[model samples]
Target: MALRTRAVLVHRRTELDELLDRHATRGQAEFFLRTRGRTLADVEARHEAATSARSAVAASVPSDWALAEVERTDLDRFLFAPEDVVLVVGQDGLVANVAKYLDRQLVVGVDPEPGTNLGVLVRHDVGDVAEIIGSLAAPRAGAGEGPFSAVRCDELTMVSARLDDGQELRAVNELFLGHPSHQSARYVLGADGGAERQSSSGLIVSTGTGATGWCASIAHDRGGRRLPGPTDRALAWFVREAWPSPVTGVTMTEGVLGRGGELVVTAQSDRLVVFGDGMEADRLEVSWGQEVRVGVAERRLRLL
Candidate 1:
């Protein structure tokens, strides 16, 4: 049997209609309408381009497209088939809205960021994402069994050390430790079995994903001279050798603690900030010897 194909056009109403006129067949294509910003002129401009393109294509093929604005509740109905292709226009925001309602279906994000929309959408919708291109394969099936599974949080320990129980954790491109007070904060950087006492305005750890974010731009001014850790040294070399790094996302899995004793985290004179995935959480303070733990999570984000 031939593969059954369904096309979903997500664009401005005018543009959607034009695309339908050119690429859609009576029984094959459907339109889902979405508008951007507040201005109608932007919508009209997109419509004109779409209509013009459709007019050009219509001369050679029979267009049998059906068009309509996609309703939020009906999104599941449209995505019911695994073979369905969703063609989205506008920015990542629009695509994000559509993805919330879709699951377990093949989604082809058309004209997405760079050459692939798959990675962009996946980063926003799920966590601990690494993009795979070209070939399609079923994701390995297991619970917390992948390369990053060891450090992933399987269960939150109730015993309070530095991090609190029920504190959710996730890894993004970077790990952010910020303060609102505009005064430098003290931190102790450490890895497995290794530790260092350092003072800074704030600290950040950047992953490959967040090599270009704020974590990369902020200067580490404290003169605690020691050979950089593998990742830190590499990032330093990158800054010296390559383009300025960009911030991606912050670490959300670990806990922030106060400096002196075993306190989850308390507000001192200076406000403590911990931000990840472009979102901010409660602010607190850290004293001289506070510890922070950051690591990957156990669960993988599955894309349909």
Candidate 2:
């Protein structure tokens, strides 16, 4: 039997959707916004644009192809198959949100508004989606071309943190090891060169994909560091505000992790946690005496 071709459309909640959720009605939301000198007009327009883009992409799917829609909040619960083609429709962050859950599936990022080039991930317009879908649905598999063979893509490196207990977490951007409440965290940080007991707010290990975010900020604050490119098999890490005391030192603050290299953190506090791409709700809890190793993952994002 031929392999089943599937398309999974991923999206996030719009500002208007959040407003309605909080205020319970458009009238109330409008009233509250009006007091702040803002109208619902802009929010409604963006919401309509996002919805239109999602609908258009959905309509482009071939009737013979199976289709599924996943909201950002449901990514963890959604089960993705190997043959799924992921079309992330939203800002660039939406792409990062879904990247951790995928396993070599081709991704097509759709910009809902499409005017500005703010996104490195969301590169295509809504009109471009139809052609991509058509290309995927064409009868070309017998000629040694797969469903998504016509499109071009780049494989981006990702970061993974494996705990001593065997649990693991991955991120397309960066991984954060810290306390849940942003309080000072205590850990023993180790690398190939050396190790140190640190007391600080937390630590961050960033991929080149994540350098655009917190990693870039940290680099800027520290007079810049040579960050790896998106396709580079490397990672960068930093310890945030490490404290110096009689028992702890602030020597190991930052470094670049090459391919096959690892950064190890042994938790010394009860509430130490690890999260990726700002998704603190989905996190790994490491207790005292537990160790987590950070490294470049073997799996890469196949982005179209």
Candidate 3:
């Protein structure tokens, strides 16, 4: 018999659940919201919508497939198989949060609250997920252009940061290297061409997938040109608030990275950190003399 497909539904807590968790009771939660001139009814309604969306997704999973539901916080502990199909049922950020943890597993991003979420990553609606999942399972004739093709999984670029100590982290959106507290960080920034010792707020290394986000803002602030697209197979780097002192020059502030291209940073501070996809809790730490290399990851996000 063939191995059954496994679907892992990823989700996060709703606001109402958080309120109840904090207050310890529905009555107390409602009262607390009331005191702030906000009604519990609104939160309740939002929770109901989310619940409905979750139910729709659960009901749509193929009966023959193995199913599991994972809370966003517990993803670190969840043991995913190589064949698992990941489903993210939250905002676009949730998609980014989970993508780094996966190794080429097909991700179906479902927008739980379509009415409110911009959902650039979580673009599919709950109603359409079953069909999308089915399509991904079915073999195709070409690059999802045939009449039999019901879905197309766009391969998004990703970045990886490998430390000299062999520690590594991947990012679907971008990677941040600097002080965890966003303070002045000193480092020797370098590439294949040359290296420079500099002091700055931090550095943001982004994939084409992250061009419209933090990278876009940085590009705009510096009067730089627009960044690469989501599938551009290149990475962009920007130094945030690079302090131009007599010692720290600002010439090496921004650039693009591709295959055989990488940005190396040698830590000049007592403590520096490398984190991917805005997840600070999951990070790699480097000491005063350590170094990290950031470049495009070998793996890509197969978005269904």
Candidate 4:
């Protein structure tokens, strides 16, 4: 059978949706917010705008294309197809949330509320989806043009961490390896030709795409370190608050993992967490004496 283009509309639960679910009714939700010195009208207005944007993007999908709507909570259960053209319709973080679950599918980010977000990832508006879909569906190799020349795309690098037991995780932003609580985490960070035992909060292994997020902030606070670009085949890692002591050293705190380089963390604490893009529920657990490897993944988010 010929592959059909599936337009997956990815969204999250709006604040109003959450309030209604928690408070059971709009009046009750309004009353609850009012008690907290916040007005429900503002929430409703934002909700209406988001709902309208989602509806507009949904209507923009090609009529012949198969349509699938997946909430942020249901992404783990949703089966994505190879020919799928994703329409990420939400905040920029939504793009990172969906990237790990995808492969080479062309992702068109539809920013619902413009000017509010940094526009680092979701670069298109609701009006641009129909045209992006048309461009994606149109023929390639026009005259001297190459594949996908009709559509502009960025091949963004991602970070992947693998444990010894065959479990693996990928993230477009960064991979956080830490203790469940905010307590001290014990581990040995191995990267850039050396290894050292350190006791600290945890480690954040990020990519060029993630550089603009958490890693960038860390870089700025630490007097700024160069990070890889979005298309660069590299990954950067930072050891948070590494303490200098008799047994632990802080010199191996932060570094970049070039091409084939990797970050190997040997667990010394009871249990260390490894999650990507803030999805802690769905994550890898590393116990004492176990090893986890973090590096640039072979899969890249082909974002449009």
Candidate 5:
């Protein structure tokens, strides 16, 4: 039997949804914001735009394709197949959230409010979704000139952290290894085989796709260190606020990691966290005596 093509629409809850979840009622939510010198109009407008964009995407999906909808919060529970084509309809962060769950799946990012959101990753406007999907669904004819050529995508690199316990996690942009409370975290960090013990706020392992976000900020603060481009296969690692003390050192603070190379970190704290793309709530906890190896992931994001 032939494999079925599934279309997965990944989305995150809107700001208004969060406010209402907290306040129970729209009026109450407005009142709570008003007390803080804020207005509900902005949040409501964003919610409306998100709703309109999602509805348009739903209508555009063809009937023949098997459809599945997964929220960002529920991504861990969703099972994605290799034949799936994922569509992220929201901010650029949503694309990052969904990328790790996919393997060889094509992703289409739709900006809900293009005028306000900078959407560096979510580059396609809502109107461009249909054409993009059509191109993806069409059969490829030749090399670069085909109607369905995969060249219409921006192939982005990603990072993966595998624990010694056999559990693994992938990041579209970067992976943060640090204390869950952002306190000083103690650990031994190593690249390839050389190692050192260090105390720092945390360690950031970033991919070329993540060079623009947290990694870029760290580089900017450190006299503007050079960073990799979005498609570069090499990864960059930075130790945030590495404190030099009697037992801690900052010698292995920052560097680029290419293929066949790896960054190893051993846990020294009672509890450490490894989260990706700024989603702290979704993370992996590393306790004492555990080791994590971070490197370029085998999978890549094919952004159309």
Candidate 6:
């Protein structure tokens, strides 16, 4: 029997037309276009390239596949198809767009962390909330089917007092604690019972993926030499110069920590912001002697 397959085309419009004209083997396949600026010919060329790539990938599989591009408003329509396999293209934006349309347990091709727009959208849509680094003492069990079945963080470590059953957590490029409004924040950094008070513009904790982006960018601006390892190279280039790094480098699970661990945070500030996977979580007031818990979530993004 011929396997039935469905593919979604996500790219610039000119590219979409070209892909449909060239790679579309049958009329049943769907093509979703995401074109911005380009002439008709340019779009056609892009489509041709994309379609050919898809065909090559599909040929190895046993299932029959169709192709199409999705409209912003019609995501729900495509998502409802239980048998359709949606393929997203482009860079970071592709991951974000794909998450919005996914209601089922579909895999994507990207990293799973807060810094990523896709991670934020997935966390928000699924309703998995993270607390301060010290607050995750026990997993809270509740009724009802969760929006997401699992949450997974790649190349991240968690340090928490305790973790609850079914409440998943993970670390990413880094963890940032600061106020959006420019202000000096005070915090204590240490493991176990020992801690010290330090004041600085802000504090940020980064994993390997976050090293290159905002974290690395800030280091370069401050005249800090590049740190070695895959951890520092991932998102280091994406970091902006305006933001500063954490004052004290408190060692938690340094040197290749796994998915689940804990990083204790105690700080003094009227308002504190916690960023994971590179997105903001609900804000909290960091008072003296108060602890923020951190951990990894169970959901993982399926990247194509």
Each model's total of backbone clashes: 16, 0, 0, 0, 0, 85
lDDT of candidate 6 over 117-181, digit per residue (tens): 34421222111221211121123232123311232322222221222222222333455555556
Note the Cα lDDT for every prediction shown. Answer: 0.34, 0.90, 0.86, 0.87, 0.85, 0.40
Residue 291, model 6: Cα distance from true site in angstroms: 1.7
Q: Of the candidates shown, which would achieve the greatest TM-score relative to the real structure?
A: 2
Question: What is candidate 4's lDDT per residue for 1-304, written digit by digit as tens?
Answer: 5456788999999999999999899999999999999999999898988899889888887787889999999998999987788889888899999999997777888878765653878898887777877777665433222234345689999999999999999999999999989578988888877899999989989898899888999999888999899899998888889888898888888888887889889999999999999999889999999999999899989898
Q: Which sections of candidate 5 miss by over 4 Å? A: 140-151
Q: Candidate 5: TM-score?
A: 0.92
Better by TM-score, candidate 4 or 3: 4
Clashes, model 1: 16
Which residue pairs in candidate 5 collide? none
Q: Which is the leading candidate under lDDT?
A: 2
- Is 2 or 3 the stronger prediction by lDDT? 2
- Model 6 misplacement above 4 A: 1-90, 93-106, 109-173, 192-194, 218-261, 277-289, 295-300
Candidate 2: the clashing residue pairs are: none
Model 6 scores worst on lDDT over the 10 consecutive residues at 125-134
Structural RMSD, model 6: 14.2
| Model 4 TM | 0.93
Off by over 4 Å in 1: 1-40, 43-162, 212-270, 281-291
What ranking emerges by lDDT with the best candidate at the front?
2, 4, 3, 5, 6, 1
Return model 3's CA RMSD, one decimal: 3.1
- Mark the regions of model 2 whose C-alpha exceeds 4 Å error after superposition: 140-151
Report the Cα RMSD per candidate: 14.4, 1.9, 3.1, 2.5, 2.7, 14.2
lDDT score for residue 13 of model 2: 94
Cα lDDT of model 5 by residue, 1-304, tens digit = 4356678888899989999999999999999999999899988998999989888877777777788888999998999986677889988888998888877677888888866554667877788778876766566454342222344578788999999999888999999999999999999998866899999999998988788888999988878877778788889899999999999998889999998689999999999999999888888899997999999888888887
